[model samples]
Every structure is written in C-alpha cells, then in structure tokens.
Target chain A: MLPPALSDKQTVPFDDRGLAYGDGLFETVLLRAGAPVLWRYHTDRLAKGCRRLNIPLPCQAALDATWQGDCTAELEVLKLILTRGSGGRGYAQPDEVTPRLLSRRTPFQPSIQRWQQGVTVRLCDLRLSRQPRLAGIKHLNRLENVLARQEWSDAAIAEGLLADSEGRVIEATSMNIFWLQAGQVFTPLVDQCGVAGTLRAGLIDQGVVAQRALLLDRLAEVERLWVANSVQGVWPVTTLLAADGSLLQRWAVSDSDPFQRLAHQLLGFA
Target chain B: MLPPALSDKQTVPFDDRGLAYGDGLFETVLLRAGAPVLWRYHTDRLAKGCRRLNIPLPCQAALDATWQGDCTAELEVLKLILTRGSGGRGYAQPDEVTPRLLSRRTPFQPSIQRWQQGVTVRLCDLRLSRQPRLAGIKHLNRLENVLARQEWSDAAIAEGLLADSEGRVIEATSMNIFWLQAGQVFTPLVDQCGVAGTLRAGLIDQGVVAQRALLLDRLAEVERLWVANSVQGVWPVTTLLAADGSLLQRWAVSDSDPFQRLAHQLLGFA
Candidate 1:
C-alpha cells in the first residue's frame, strides 16, 4: 500500500538532483506489526546522509506521519527516500533547496523458510569500488550493487557477494555478511566500502561479532556464514563457491548459536 | 523543443535501474554546423562505461535515431543518457537489459568576455569520495557534484573545485581543471576520483597540455588556470579559494594559448 502522504504525487521535477544525478539517500526497513523497525537508526542515517550531501533534513513530525498512519498491513517493507529537490538543468543544485521526503509500504517479506533452510549464494564479477568517504552509508548511488545483483538469477542462487578492487570480500549486494572463522565471528569492515548495516550494527553492538576486512583469498577458511539486512533479518548461507566456480563451504547457523539467538532477540524473531 | 520521438517516446521503464540506482552513463557534446564535435570519443567512452557497468551498448540504429531529428538548432548542447532499463526492484538487475537512450538539445553558449576575463572559482567543502571503479567515467552517481554546486549562491563564483577524503584536489564540480605549474601543465588524475572530461582529453590529445595528479597546496602557485567541459568548452579562472574558507591565488590564462584559439575556432566565438 502506498503511503498516504505520497498518494497525491505529481511528476518529480525533471531537474530533481535525485533523477538527474542520483543525489539522494534512502533507507528500507521491515515494517512488522505495522510499525517500522529501527525507525531511529533509519531516520538518523537519512539525516546524516542529507547533511553530507548539503541537503537540509526534513521535519521529523512530517516524516513520521508519512510513515505511521493509515496502514492496514501488519508486515510490510517501508522505504524512505529523501532527495535534494529540483533546480538548474545541470548538476549544480539550486540555492534554495526544497527537500523531498517520501515513504511507501509494500506487502513483501522474504520467505521465513528460506532463512531457516539457508540460501544458495554466488560470487559476482562486479566489485564494489573502495570509497571510504561514502562507505558505510546507505546512499542512493548504488550502481555497483545493482550490477553485482544482476550477475545471477537462478532461483537456486539467493544472493551474490562482491569484493573490492583489492580482492577484499566486501559484502553481499543488499546485506552485511558475517563469517565464522576458527570459532571467531567477523564481518567485513565497511570503513572502506559497503554499508554499515543497521542489523549488523545491533549484532556488533551486542558483542556477537567483530568487524574486520575479509580477504577474498581466505574464503576457504570460513566455517559458517550468514547475511543480515534490515529487511531480511538474518539468512544463513548454505553454500559459498570459489571464483573458479567451485564449492567453498556451506553453513547453517542453528538458533542455538549465541549470535543467532542474539539476532533473533534483537529482530523480534525470537 | 521536445523531440517528436516523444510521441512514441520509449524511455526508462518506471523501475529503471538507472533511475533507481543511477546505473548509467551519459555524454553531452556540442552540435555545431549539423555535426557532433568529438562524437567518436563520446561514444567510445559511453560504450566503455556501459561495459564497466555490465549494461549492453545501444545499437547503431538507436544511436543514430537518438540525435537524428534533434540538434536542429544552429548550435546546441546534445545530451544522451543511456540507462539499464527497468526491473530488479532490489539491487539485482534484470537478466536481459534494455538500455534507454534519451537525447535532448539545450541552447547554451558561454560568453566570449567571460572566457577572456576568466571566471571566479571557490573550493567546495564537500569532498568527493574516492571510488576508483566509477572514477574517470561519466556515470550518473553525481551527488557529490550536486552538493558542491549547491554550496554558494554568489553569481560571481562560476565553479567550485572539490577534493577527495585524503584532501587531494580532484576536479571542479562540473568540469576538469588544468593549471600550469613550474612550466608544466597538470590536472588531477581521475584514477582515485573525478571524471576524465571529454574536453580535457581533447586538450591532452592535441599535445597542447600535460596531465598529472595535482595537490591542493600547489594549485595556488600555478601560473595560469582553466576549466573545461564538453558543453562549456574552456574558461580561464581569475580567482581561487579553498574550502577552508581561505583565499588562494588567482590566475587567468593568456587568450593567445593555442588551445583557447582552437576553442574559439571550433565554437564560433568572436
């Protein structure tokens, strides 16, 4: 269901920075029980991204109303997009910036069974370029991710992993990845590239895992793995393959693992 | 005028990857005397960029028709945007991709006096994040450029220069910058960041200038400075300032430079 605030939409101005240059940031969160999870984190990231882009963040009340009321669905995916409003035909943004805040709800959720059974994964040919300045932030300039996700479509393949130019395994196309190596848990350090996922944050903050750069050459050493995003919560990777397209490892994080237990507790999956 | 092609205008599907994630490449060239200046270079770069992003290059027939009826004006700016067409709601792109090419003409010609007197420039506080994969290519993920351009409203300031996270000077908001330092021309290498501008390439190809990484500290010491873009041709800089809100040196290239003369000849400037 489309959010009420966005129901009376007109044509997004041709000069909008978002359309002209992808000059914007967006956050997608799982809406359970008709309430957006981690609303604070999503809003904070949106504001921080706006500040970095020199766009003034919009009002919180207005934003909350846009996402809050008139939603009948209990489970949905809520997407928030904030763009530097229209201006000069060229890239130069207008002096008086009018920001656009939009919210929409879609009745969508990943199959719970898939998360439990673990999903197949592939290694994408496209690499996420290292951009420390833009890394760890969920901005709208996601062509790299788009290309990475496009690499495979077999229903058997659930997600694709991307690496940096230096062959450091960064993250999956849409989720933060964690691998259990030598009984230690680690996820890629997003300081150089990849989004600092909200769910990843909760897991890390809860002392379940550490963040470090994962070199692609060492993929064979990992014993178990899983991916997390705001929407998917936690999905075990049943299989990981080598770049030469050979099986590397398979993983199943039982609900018994302390980390998995923590994830379930934090995500309300418990 | 909107192209008659608009009558049946097939453009980005509502969910175009380009529009959603800025997964695309674009080229804007000057159409004068009924021919596109630097057409081959523009098309070559576009094809290379498409390959980098894994999007199929447009067909020759589509390319020809993109600009055929357009550019009717005696002189105009012809812009062509090619995007990975629709689908893939998330980061994943569709298995089969249809690239959308939109061509339009804009009436634009920089004033002769502005080029002669030189334009004012300011350093942008918004540093461009370095993403080498997208560097040197004219892709649509240009939020940094948009933010830098939004910094000030002083009409006198014609352009803003940006640096990367490490404080290395990159490029101007909308153009490539070149300066003569110690009797050798230098432009920041785009390997770490920034676009490899078409006009900048022309100047280097014609053996009129040299190119290299330029430090922000060295910019003030340059004997002369100029900025170039496909649409703006070239313009000398009379003033320079750092993003720290400090004044740098000012410079204006002599009108007698062979490159300036060539620009005048090619652009039909008096």
Candidate 2:
C-alpha cells in the first residue's frame, strides 16, 4: 500500500501496537522557519529509542517528509510517533515487524511568558519508576508523567518536578531540568530514568552541561534552575513549592540568563 | 456520537491517549460456551484501573454491549481495551474525559498439552520497573512484557517469568504464576509490580492461595509450579530455565495436581 497521504492520521490501525501496548517511540519537534529545530538531536534520540525498543526506524524519507508542510506559522509543533506497526500476536512482537509512523502538527503556543518571567514549579508526590532500558527513550509508556502533571491544576504552576523512586530528582513533568550551582550546570542522569530532552542533549553535546546523579535534596541546594524541551525553549524556574504549597526556594530570573542565551545560539532562534 | 457500534473498533482516534502515552487499561476474558468466564473479576479490575487513572468508565449498558454478539466458538478470547478517549493538552488530562472502548474476539486455542504435560518456562533478563500506582492495573504501558516475551523464540518454552527491579518474581510474561510447596500454595505479591490476573484473583479470593513476596532466587526451591491466566486456563510448569538456557528447576506435574483441579473447578472448564 502507498504511504498515507500527508494528512491522513487515520491510517493507524486500532491494533497498532502503539495503541495496544505502547510499543513505540515519539518525538515532538519544534518546527520553526518551516524546519524542525535541532532535527539531528531529535533524530539521534529517536534512533536510539528505536534501537533500544527494537522498533525499526522509518526510512530517512518517511522521517523527513513528516515536516514538509507549509511554513506559514513561524513556530509550530510536529508530533511524530513510530510504533512497531499494526500486527502482533499479543505482547510477542511479529517476526517481520514494520514500524508505523504518525505525525500531527499543532500551532506552537510559545511559553515565552513563562520563559521571560520564569515560573513556579511544584514537587510531584508521584515518583517516577526506574527502568534503565526504557529510560532516555521517548517511548509511549508515560503514565507517570500524566499522573504527575495532574497533581496540580493551579494555572500559575507551570511545571511539576518528578523524583525517581529512589528520591533522585529526575525531570519536570514535560521537560528535562538543569540547575546551576557555583557556576557549574548539571542535569539528572537519564540512564536510570527520565526522558533526555533534545535540548538537554544539545547542551550536553556542546559541553556546556553535565549529567550527574541528582538526589531530590540537592534541588533545594541549587542556586538556579530551569526546565526546557525542544518545543518550548528554556523556562527559568523562579519558584519551587512543596506538594502542600509551602515555599522551598525562590530566585530572580535574569533577562540575560546564560543558559537561555546558549540555548538560543544553538537553536538559531530569535 | 452514540458510543461506537459494538463492532467499530476503528473509532479509536490515532492520537488516542492509549496510543500516545500508554494511558489506558485492558482485560482479556475467556468466552466459553457463549459466556464469559470469571466476568466479575475482569469488571472489578477494569473499574479499579479506570478509577486509578481517572479515565471515566462507561456505564453498565456500554460496557455490557461490547460483547453482545454470537459466540459460536465454544472457547474464544475476548480482548477488551478502554482508553482515555482522544484529545488533551499533551499529558495534562482534559477536564471532561470520555473513555473509548475496543473489543476483539479470537478463538482460544486451549493448551491442553501444556496443561496436561507441564511445559517448560524461562526466566527473562528484562526486569520490570517498580511503580505501585501502575502495579496490578493491567494498563496499556506493557513494553516490559513485550520485551520479556521477545526474549525467547523456542516454541517449546510456553512462558517467561519476570522479576521486578528489586529482584522479586512478579509474574510470567502473560500469566500469573503459582507454586505448591509442602502442600501450601503461594503466588507473588503484585503490590509493587506485575499484572494481577483474574484467575489469580479467583484463587486468592477463594482463600486457597496465599500471597507473599517471592524473590527470583526462591523459584528454584518450589516443588511444583504453574502459570495461569483467564484466556489460556492453567498450565503446569515442568522445568524452569534461566535467560541463557541454564537449568534452574524441574518438577513432575501430576494428573491429580491439587492446584490444577481447584483452578478447573474455579474456571468451570471441562
């Protein structure tokens, strides 16, 4: 059969293993200036996820073609999903598996307000499960994040920070986190758990950020903190709150923060 | 829409949360002689799962109607899926969430031989993550099971047993496991991990089986072991092998195995 028309998101069979078992990987790309921002980092992570999950990566054309739509919007979101295809005998994957790809574009509602003024973050009571094999890969098994995200509905709270089962601060509900302490920047190691965001990877790749085993207690000790992802850029977290809404730490976000400037330089964004 | 026709599985949107982030729950029930076996157990689990995930469960009419059809085949499998219906701002659930239901039926090929002449089982290297909130829900986030099931291709091996990250034996890739020792029956506690099977519940609820924390190393000490589920019935396990095919334990399954007899009476299978 021909590849689905660029618009038919209906091609995914209800039996697609992604729907059946979440046997898939996904990448939400920032399509700015008609091209995906940090495309290579997204590709690298997707490839790594596919390799780890044993789901074949789609051909380069199929991957590239997902973002070929009109560039009318300066900034948009490209949500890409690739599953271990339509047929599988229960949890036993098909012997000859073909991966299915689905992409959806939504207008990017830039969180510049959150980025400029910074945002209040909360400590989620729900801790993330540790699965090193499934960690770092943006696989579809994200109930932990969903549950954590639902912890608070207060509009002022922009993100919820998650800790691993062992009390190690992992990441925010939707983004990877990095903190500066005495001039050195560090993000939690995703090898044990958590999605390693493309922006986080770009920073690590550029040697500006380092990954370390970050315990939850260390969050209170950090000088400055920020949450970031491929779609929303960098969000300086000015306030941290306990689940009970008690104050933990508060900081003044600078307009010319070093990480924000570096992130802008890497993505070539205004 | 009128809750989809009993047959239109296609109504599941491609972006349904189940497919997007494993945000769903499922139950596979046994349809024997035009009726579902252990129906109440399945319903109880489904309701519990939906409540925990905050996915709205369909009313009695919609839930019951999913299986309103001719069950010509004496023994068949009914796969029921309930996903948090489409559309949400990423992982933050929609304020008003309606769940989508999908059911499919296939002939249940009874593993008489595996049941009568105990089948061999293998240990899996892929350890399950510990998430108490997700434990026992039988949610759609099942990549761990898929990965474990893929570990072996030997048709001789009927199942693979899984251990949680804490090195505790949780369950088989597709079934819950029970063992007999000194005339006492025990199964693993699924409070930290594993799907608590309907059949396992039947045994436990009957007060015939005891639940305890079973570690991976303890499996070798059992006198007789069996893996069971609602659809496949009960299969006596004769030999257990490590992931690398090293022998761990073996047992002579009896025609008058006490657990098998009780399970048969509980399931009411001829």
lDDT of 2 by residue, B13-118 (tens): 6668888999999989888876788988999999899888988777767777766688868888888888887778889988877777888778777778887998
Please give the lDDT score at residue B163 for candidate 2.
Answer: 93
lDDT of 1 by residue, A196-257 (tens): 88888777877888988888878757888787787887778888865456787776657666
* Local accuracy of candidate 1 as per-residue lDDT tens digits, B1-270: 112122134333335555568888878887875577777778778877977887788766676565667455777778777777666658766666666667666766666667777888898877777666678889989876766777877787888988887778888888888877766666788887899877777767777667777767777877888887766767888888776556787664574765566655544553
The prediction achieving the highest TM-score against the true structure is: 2
Per-candidate interface DockQ score: 0.44, 0.76
Poorest 10 consecutive residues by lDDT, candidate 1 chain B = B1-10
Against the true structure, candidate 1 reaches a TM-score of 0.85
Q: On a 0 to 1 TM-score scale, where does candidate 2 land against the true structure? A: 0.97
Candidate 2, residues A90-167, lDDT tens digits: the string is 899888887778888777767668879999999999999999889999999999998898899998999999999999
Model 1 lDDT, residue B77, Cα: 79
Candidate 2 scores a C-alpha RMSD against the true structure in Å of: 2.0
